[model samples]
Target: YTYNNRINRISIIQEHVMLRRAIERGVSTERLATALAINIAQVEKRLNLLDGICAETADLLKDRQCSADVFAVLRRMKPTRQIECAELMVSANNVTMAYARALMSASTPDRLVNAKRAPKPKGLSDEQLGLMQKEMSGLQDQYRMAEQTYGEDTLNRLLFVQEAKLLSAQALTVIAQVRFAKRQTSVDFGPSAGMR
Candidate 1:
């Protein structure tokens, strides 16, 4: 739609695309900034919009109307956390910088890019955050295990159904053959067959 392409609905992403194209065409950054009427810093930032971002997260947000600051927030977390945050944003229809920061805040230190340098929440003590992190990690593990089990169960059920269908087809073929055999054996005798 015009809103997406021209009206900056997908602002940073569209700019990134244009910037990449210009860069590939050997356009200087200053020239690009002048052409786009933005500063060189912004032009460079747009060019590196997906620099540290994982492909999956970028794909998830490529079409959505997300704040550029959201990427800056996401870039702080590890790839897995970035993916989780992106999925949350997409599902909840909220891609503001605040939401991204909230998601980052909820993430365990281990999921951060530099766990040692990770920031703590304003209210929660380190001990409390650790406890919450453990609980969240446990829940994530349970979800992954359940998902694997469900996938295996589904595959087994499908294989069973396919086997059952094949058996049914074979049974039908055998029944048909038996009926033909019976008809062959029950052929009528000629009028003088008994006398012969």
Candidate 2:
């Protein structure tokens, strides 16, 4: 068979959606397997990959370059939790199956789709789970705060560079304006005022 270069690489969601559409259009799993050069069981697995996933979660991950196994892990999570985990994975630039599994393990039982059969992490007690959830929440808050401050931090650095490029009086004036702005914003300027 000739390699089909026209078929560009597709994401996990695309593969699942395509397979699902084929099945819905009365395509046989055996035929799909032959066309994709995979086994019938694998074709069926792909077709059913999004069986229990919510539309919102699927939409969130539609463009993500996650693996099929990542979706498999995500399917165990509730819709809201799935979105949160997907966001974290995207922010961290990690969409691996292992990362998905770690997120699943870190999730609280209430956040799982099958709460009655929630998978327990090895060596993790209930207390540990609670602590992990709290720590994850705190880390997520810190990540958001850092992201919000990133542009301001860049602007501050540029202002410092501009001040350094100017003459002493201009530089001092710029520094004073910056300090005044920082004070107005309630940002700590530390003991740098003593340097002047």
Candidate 3:
């Protein structure tokens, strides 16, 4: 006899919680792998997904639709940097592993959680890294400014367009009234040819 089982898709947050609970309940990785019908490595990866993540960063990303790999990349950054990167990703509507890795690459050594284990640059020199850090700082400032002004700018544009439309309608109405009045005056006074 064969038994068919239906498995529901789980969110990243839910998976993390389940893995943590399983560990707390003295469940082994092998048991989790068997239960989930996944490989032992996959079970271990999910179990350690939030191992190095700070509470604040975890809370910030709890409701996000990002994958476990994205959180793994974020674990390389310090708490403050993690929060900043998470906020940036959320604001940009991007929560991909690539974006997280890019943020990690742009992070300075001091901003990383494990500065000693920082990835060595293959082709780029220290000077290039410094320049990149400065550029990233400038970009972050610009992003914040844009975020702050977005709503106000949108409202201003909407008001301007509405006012222009209102003015255009009023102008058209006035022009039509003027044309009607002129036609009436011309009729009352008789044709110019008749006057001549």
Candidate 4:
């Protein structure tokens, strides 16, 4: 039965939990195996699995006694990510704003250092300057939205990890069901009718 497989997985997870508890309690493997109703070999398999896990994660999987510490460590290890596309767009937008500001500031021909007395190329027309300001504001809004979306994606990744753990737990249930089914006797309907 598939239950058998689930049973196996549950047993393994249980063994792992036991081994971790043993480590925390300073209990001997022999005692832990006895307590868990599993042989020493199985206990060792669980220990090996624990040995490979990182300290912070192992702590989380085990007793969860210091959740604050675990969270702090995770924060430190979190990646330093940047939104490249958004950054590029922001840079381009900044350049455009600067250009517009320069045009707006340019002195008229009457005031130009070189114009001495001629008119300037007509300092940025009011309409064009207003349009430039609007475009700059729009880009800034887009940049803000981009950052928000990136943060949301990071949250999604954390959720996915949690979901994976849930699925793994479900797998154990399925395996147990398989194991149980396999132990059942089925009647043969063809060729050997009523041979039970």
- All models: lDDT? 0.83, 0.83, 0.86, 0.49
Candidate 1 vs. true structure, TM-score: 0.63
Candidate 3 clashing pairs?
none
Please list the residue runs of candidate 3 whose C-alpha ends up more than 4 Å from where it truly belongs after superposition: 1-8, 188-196
Query: How does model 4 score by TM-score?
Result: 0.25
Q: Please provide the root mean square deviation of candidate 3 (C-alpha atoms, Å).
A: 5.5
User: How displaced is residue 38 in candidate 1, in Å?
Assistant: 1.5
Best by TM-score: 3
What lDDT tens digits, residue by residue, belong to model 1 across residues 5-119?
A: 5563545677688779989999999998898798999888888889889999988998887777889899999998999888778866888999887777778777889877766
Clashes of 4: 22
Which stretches in model 4 have alpha-carbon errors above 4 Å? 1-129, 168-172, 175-183, 187-196
Instruction: Tell me each candidate's TM-score.
Output: 0.63, 0.74, 0.83, 0.25
The backbone clash count of each candidate, in order, is 0, 0, 0, 22
lDDT of 2 by residue, 51-71 (tens): 778787788778777778888
Structure candidate 1, residue pairs in collision: none
TM-score of 2: 0.74
Which residue window of length 10 is worst by lDDT in model 1? Answer: 3-12
RMSD, each candidate, Å?
7.6, 13.2, 5.5, 27.8
Better of 3 and 4 by lDDT: 3
Evaluated against the true structure, the overall lDDT of model 1 is 0.83
lDDT of model 2, residue 167: 74
Instruction: Using TM-score, rank the candidates from best to worst.
Output: 3, 2, 1, 4
> What does candidate 4 score in Cα RMSD to the true structure?
27.8
